[model samples]
Target chain A: MAEIVLNALAHTYSRKPNAPQDYAIRQMNQVWEQGGAYALLGPSGCGKSTLLNIISGLLEPSDGEILFDGVKVNSLPPEERNIAQVFQFPVIYDTMTVFDNLAFPLRNMKTPAHLIQSKVHEIADILELSPLLHKKAKNLTADEKQKVSMGRGLVRDNVSAILFDEPLTVIDPQLKWKLRRKLKQIHDQFNITMIYVTHDQLEAATFADKIAVMYEGQIVQFGSPHELFENPKHTFVGYFIGSPGMNFMNVQLEEQHFVFEDMKLKVPEKILDKIQHLPYESIKLGIRPEFVHVWDKKNDEAYEVDVIDSEDLGTYHIMTFKLRNQLLKARLHEDQRIPKHKAWISFPDQWLKVYVNEYLVEADDE
Target chain B: MNKIENNKAWFLVLPVFVLVAFSAIIPLMTVVNYSVQDVFDTNTRYFVGTEWFKAILNDAALQSALMKQFMFSFTTLSIEIPLGIGIALLMPKRGMAASLCLVLIALPLLIPLNVVGTIWQIFTRSDIGLMGWSLREMGVAYNISRNPVDAWATIILMDVWHWTPLIALLCYSGLRSIPEAYYQAARIDRASRWAIFRYIQLPKLTNVLIIGILLRFMDSFMIYAEPFVLTGGGPGSSTTFLSQALTTMAIGQFDVGPAAAFSIIYFLIILAVSWVFYTTIMNMQKEK
Candidate 1:
């Protein structure tokens, strides 16, 4: 397996992409270490598939170079690039038996007859498709068909990476969990670089070792799931990851206090110093809904807000409140007292994030 | 629950009854009546008791003509199916060029049957037509009337030119319905071009090809107007087909009794052949 590197890669569907809007994938760079489980996570139509296609060599990038193990692979076809891709929908040869479907890649490579047979059996056993090997692929259920498709890729040993593009969209919710666990097992067993692309944050977080948060055709932040939740580098990530997501309020810096619409809050010296180095234009303050501490009584550092709406979501409650006319969300535990119409909230220093131009500013050295 | 036997539902089916009667049963009954009768006039007809049917079945010329018709249909099918698939495979998948090509290929299919006959009739003229004149200039001796081989070749070529596009268009739509992901997966699997076609394209195209084959077979089997216009049972009745023979007996010579029997036999042949083809293809699908 090779370490995949996308060096300043960009792509566009137009013949001449003169404007930035014309590009489907804007110029960016990313690297996936060998055997790393990475998820390229984004909303629908955010170029997650485009990036995956490029990495799989199905679609060549308009600009920049793709290196595998530090060697350029721009001129290589997908077959020569040694990459396998599983698509959003299961793709299998309908006329063939499940055994033949799994054996396809090895047969294509002209592996010896006995090796092909043994490899097919191995992959079929791993996918739990040994019993259905004699059955036609067309007759299988959606998840079984998906496993067969994935098994086609796994049958070959020469592949450098396996790219999955929303492979669970067609599967029912009940089966998705089992299939995902199977994928995790496969990853652990084979130690090959796997890049999973999806719009569901839960799928990304649960399956990937490192989740790359993509926004507007760019990878905004790449880190572990815990890191992405603890610190979303971009405002989009903050708004995307959690249940109600992180609440963001546009603020202006004035006299060491962050001022918003009809509201003001003092900042610590270290955070203020970091904010000073960043441009004062387009400043925003962000905090996760889980971290916004709601209080029944007014504290010294608390800002009182009207509790506009609160949803009882079984275990916890998501309370939407207005802070100085700006709406915000906070997650409260089940045992916490429910505020009627008014609640005092405090943005704790540790949870508060100062954003300059929609990008998070480090309040302290890591 | 009480079971009520109501006779009123039959009235609700009157439209279908009248439709089936007018469209099928009436005409078929008339043919059967003619097949079994010796009718000098509508008022003076006698029950002949299968005499005409026996006579028609025993006709040697008509038997040869049926054989000739089968040959024509078989040849045209064998040529058109593979050629159509090849053309579909080679066709551009999208954009302005694809649109232009589709329209051009469909042009001949829209032409009236007689018009197609007239076009090919003139187009293959040895003296003036583009192709015929070119062949004559190239020192090739080609005359559709005097030579049986030339006549057969011309009719087959004309039929291929007129009908290959229908199959091609069906196959093109079928090929387009296949997801792009299949091809991408094949590429990643390192499949050869032939392997992709064999396992992917051909399997996906099975239903469309079945429909195309049955359609072409039935249409070619019943073909009349084009060949009739071009040849008119020419030279020595060498190109006479089942429909042409029936038309000559019923309309040309007013041999209604034998011609009615002939038409019924022709209809049965088409039905039986199409059913056989459909069932065979379906069984193949099931076995796979």
Candidate 2:
């Protein structure tokens, strides 16, 4: 186990990346401390898998230095790097028994039969696959096959890190939870540095200590789940993380205040000062759907909007309101009163996030 | 919950049934009829009651031919399977090169068996042929007509040259069907090249290999044309296989009853061996 550092890592499928879009993974530097669990989180085709493959040495970065324990391993093969990767679909040797499948890596290193047996038994017991030891890997169900793949990774003691590229994509929803918990338990037990790649925010939040949010082939933000929720470093993160996500409204700094359409949104003085200095022409105001307080009366600091649609989502309600052709969503709790066609809404100053050119501008916390 | 009996569907199957009966059953019955009786003429025949089968089984020339047939089939399979896999592995996977290699490798298979034998016959002539002249230039005695060993070697090589491409093409398709994820996983597992072959490539090729083996075994066991054209059962019947023996008995010698029995035996052997290969390979897959 070793700390993994990617220094200005970039990958381009094309020999000559003429434009920024040509790069599958744009230039970025990141680090994973030894034994840290990180989720490379993004939507599909956002380069999470590309980054994961680069880290596992499955795909060498077109440019960059990958250092393990401060030693350059950029040119190392996956085998030499001692990295294990579990793919989106379960990959198992179809002709081998589950025991042999689990014993594969150890046997590859020519480990003695007795040692392999013990290791196989241990991993099988941990994965609850002891009963399936004699069964062919091809005969197992999807999750069981996935467990076998994981067992192959876990069988080897010298593996520096285990990279998972959306390993749960094919598993059923019921089994996804159990398998994810099993993976978490295995991480705690093995203390191997694990990087889990996924597009599901819930899976990322539940499985990883830190979630690296990727957008457009770049890691826009890296932080703990709580930090990502409270203060997303990029507007994409704010829009991607939560249920219904954070609602963003296009705004312009005019004269002294921020104007969204004809409504002048009230912002904290410190934020207003930062907004004045923002060099971008386009500005946006972001707030989580939960933070937009809906009111029955047209109170001070409240802006009037027409309710377009309201969905009753069991425990809470998500009400979509239109303010001068701009749609805004406010999540209301079960006890909160449902508004009529016309409703007055206000985004609390504490939850107000200012964005310049889609990147978060530091907001003053209440 | 009553089930409907579809008696009308039988009418729909009548056309195919009649076609199969005319094309297959009638000829097969004629062969059976010939096998069971000794016919002096169409009107006068004696019911032999397995006498022809017994006589043909005891025939030493037919026995030797059967042995030769088995030897040829087994030897060709053993050589071709691994050689085909190797060639397939070396074949380019995609793009223009792959297409070119496929066309080139398949060229030999497309030629008629007789033409292939004739081409090799002229090509192996020491006086005028490239391969034979090259061997002669190298001072090695390589004559197909003069020595049994040389004839057998040449026949086997000709068969390899003609049919190994079929196996290789099947294996190429099999290898192409395998997803890239398996290789990636193997690499991550630190699998040796041999281990990758043994575990990933070999197991994935099982289905296609079974088809290749079955087709090759049946086709080789019924070998007639190529050897007939090239060797002509030459150098003391060294290459006279089952089909040639059956041909001699039925056509050359005019022993209808015995030839019909031998034909049944040959058909049974091919059927039995094909069944065995199919069941054994399929069972191996299911068991594992």
Candidate 3:
């Protein structure tokens, strides 16, 4: 296994692309540490697959050198790179038995027959496909075929990494957890650098120790799920990384206080100090719904707004309330009283975030 | 839930049955009628009862022609199927080049059979034809007449040139339907080019190849025009296929009874062989 690095990597489907919008992957540099589980998370059409293909050497980057273990491998094909990829859909040899499907990579390496047999058996056992070893891969279910596809990746001995391109998309929801757990177990066992690309935040968060949140062909933030939820590096990250996402609204500085359409939010001096020089129209205030506290109405520091709606979700409720002319969300615990017409909510200074020009302005005592 | 039974649905299908009766059933019945009767005229006829069938089956000339027919069909299939697949694999997947390739491959298939026969006849003639002239210049005695082996070779070559495109087109469509993920996975697996073809491409091609094999087999088995135009069963009747023999008997000699029996046997052979082959290949797929 080796650390993967993308050096000034960029890609454009057009031969003479001149505009940034023409790029499928914009110029950027990143490193994936050896033996680390990482997720490249993004929405559909945000170049997640394009980036994954570049990593696996399926698509050559229009600009950049991809280094494996500090060796420039920009021209090497996937076969020479020793990278294995499991695609979005199951891609196993249909005419082969599950055993042969799993054994394919090993056989390709000209590995001994006995070793291939044991390796395939080990992988099949891990994938819960031992019973189907003799059955044709085409005869198996979609999920089973996907497992066989993954099993092939696991069968090889010298693979530098395994890339998964939304490998769980076609799986039944119940089996998703099982397969993810199996992937975790394999990561622990093999210590291969696994880069899983997906659009689902839950899938990414659970699978990777760190996730690179992509927006418009660039990775806007790369951090742990907790860091992403608490301190999003970009407005898009705040808008993408959590359930119901973070609450954000444009803010204007009026002498000392941050104001938005007569509604005011108390901004920390440190946050204000960093964003003071930025353009006024570019300023934005953000806070996660979980951090928006619903307090007692008798408290004067809290803003009491009329409740627009509250969606009951078993263990918690998402309370939407109107403050002056702006609506905001606050996640409330199941044990908390469900406010009917009005709710008093307060934004904590520590949880509040400042943004200038769509990127987070860090004001923490770092 | 109680199912709603509607007999009126079959009324919607009555047209198809009527069409089949007029197109296939009545014509086949007439052939059967002629096969079992000795008829000088419509009014003067006698029940022959297997007499024509026995004569057709036992005739040494017809038996040799049947053997030649099998050889021709088998040769053409063996050459065309692999060649078509090869051409398809070499073809580009998409773009202007791919579209151009598709149009050119489809050109041969769009030609009428009669025109194709005429084209090949003149094209392979010993004197005036390009192929014939080129071969003569190269010191190879290439004549579709006067030499049995040369006639057989020319006819087989012409059949391949005319018909291989159908197989290629079918294979190209089949290859296109396979997702790009397969090739990606194959590459990631470090599969050799041969391995990719053997395990991935070939397996995916089985369905289309079955169609290719069946269509080519039937057409080549019943081949008449091209060879009839090129050689006319010449060179001591060495290349006289079953259809030519049947044509001589039915039209030239006016032996309608024997020709009818021969036609029935020919139809049965094609049907039985195609069914057996299709089932065998399908079962092989299932086992895999």
Candidate 4:
């Protein structure tokens, strides 16, 4: 296994990318440490697959260098790179038995027959496919076919990394969890660098130690799941990573105070002191719906808002509110009372994050 | 769930049944009637009771024609299947060049069968044809009308030129239907080029290859028009095929009893061979 490093890697489908939209993958520089489980998380068409393809050497980057273990391998083809990839759809040789499908890579390398058998048996046992060894690959279920695809990767002797591009999209929901657990078990046993790409946050959080959030062909934030939920580096990350997402409102900074329409919000003294040194005019305040505390009585630092709608989601109620012309959502517990027309909500100081130009801004920053 | 049982839906199928009967079954019954009788004329006929069938089976001319017919079908299929696959492999995968190559390859398939024969007849003529005149100028004696080898070669070449495109087109569509991910996965698996072809491309092309082979076999077995126009079964009976012999007996000589028996035998051979091809290929796929 090797530590994969992307040094200023960028790719564009067009020969000449005159604008940012023309680029499928904007410039990126990141390192995937050896034996680390990482997730490249994004919505559809946000260049996650393009990035995965580039990393696997399926698509050469337009401008950059890829280094495996600090060796420049930018011009190397996928076969020479020793990188295995599982695709979104299950890909298996339909005419081959499941045993032969798992033995394919080893057989291609001209490995001895006995060695190939052992490797095949090992992977099949791990994937719970031992009983299907002699069956034709085409007759298997969708998830079993996917298991064979992954088994092809695991059967190899020297794969530097295994890249997965939403490998669970075709699997039944109940089977997806079992397959994901198998993947984790494989990662623990093999100790190879694994990069999983997906749009589902739960899948990413459950699989990878670190999640790289991509938006508009750029990785806006890379951190653990806890960090992504608590202190998002970009507004997109905050909005993308949560169930209800972080609620953000456009605010203006006036004489060391934050103003949103007619509601005035109090800022901490340290944040207020740092506000004078802000570099941008556009400002926003963000807080997770789970952190928005609602009260029926007027309390200190509370603002009144009209309740537009409320939905009881069994475990929690998602209450929608309107302040001036902006809509806000708050999540309440099952035992919590639902206020009538008007409700007072409080944004805790620690939970409130300030954004300057759609990027997170720290109070301690210069 | 309760099942709905209704007999009225059969009325919708009656139209197709009537069409099949009028087009196929009725004509076949007439042939059966003729095969079992000695028809001297419409008014004068006698029951032959398989006499014509036994005589036609023992006829030396019909036996040789049947041999020639099998040889021709086998020769053309052996040449065209490999040649068409090669052309498909060399063809471009995408963009304007792929479209241009497709159109060029499909040009000969659009030509009428009789027109193709006439074109080749002129093309192989010694007097005014480009290929024939050039071969003579190069000191090669090539005359389809006189020499059996030259006649056989020319007919095979003509059949190849006229029908190789059908196999190529079927194979091209089959190749296009394979998703791009298979190739990528093969590359990542470090499979050799030949390995990719053997496991991926060849397996995926199995269905189309079956269709191509069976179509070529059945068509070439019943081949007429082209060879009839080109050689007129010339020099000797060397190039006379089963269809030409059947045509001479039925239409030229008006031997309706023997011709009807020969037609039934021809239909049975085609049906048996096609069924064999289909079942063998399908079983091979399942076994793998």
Report the lDDT tens digits of candidate 1 across residue range B135-253: 88999998888878888889999999999999999999999999999999999999999999999999999999999999999999999999888777676888989999998889988
Predict model 3's lDDT versus the native. 0.89
True contacts recovered per prediction: 0.86, 0.89, 0.95, 0.86
| Residue ranges of candidate 3 with Cα displaced over 4 Å | A279-281, B1-17
Question: Model 1 chain A: which ten-residue window has the lowest total lDDT?
Answer: A272-281
Per-residue accuracy of model 1 over A186-268 as CA lDDT, tens digit each: 99999999999999999998899999998888899999999999999999999999998899988888888888876778877
Docking class of 2: medium
- Among the numbered candidates, top lDDT falls to 4
Q: Is candidate 1 or candidate 2 better by TM-score?
A: 1
Writing each residue's lDDT as its tens digit, candidate 2 over B1-288 gives 999998997899999999999999999999998999998877989999999999988999889988999999999999999999999999999899999999999999999989998998999999999999999999999999989999999999999999999999999999999899999999988888998899999999988998899999999999899999999999779988899888888899888999999989889999999998788877877754
Question: Pairing residues by index, what is the TM-score of model 2?
Answer: 0.96
Candidate 4 clashes between residue pairs 3 or more apart in a chain or in different chains: none
Higher-lDDT candidate among 2 and 3? 2
Model 3 Cα shift for residue A299 (angstroms): 3.1
DockQ of each: 0.78, 0.77, 0.74, 0.74
When 3 and 4 are scored with lDDT, the better candidate is: 4
lDDT of 3 by residue, A337-358 (tens): 8888978888887788888888
* A345 Cα displacement, candidate 1 (Å): 1.3
lDDT of 1 at A339: 88
Best by DockQ: 1
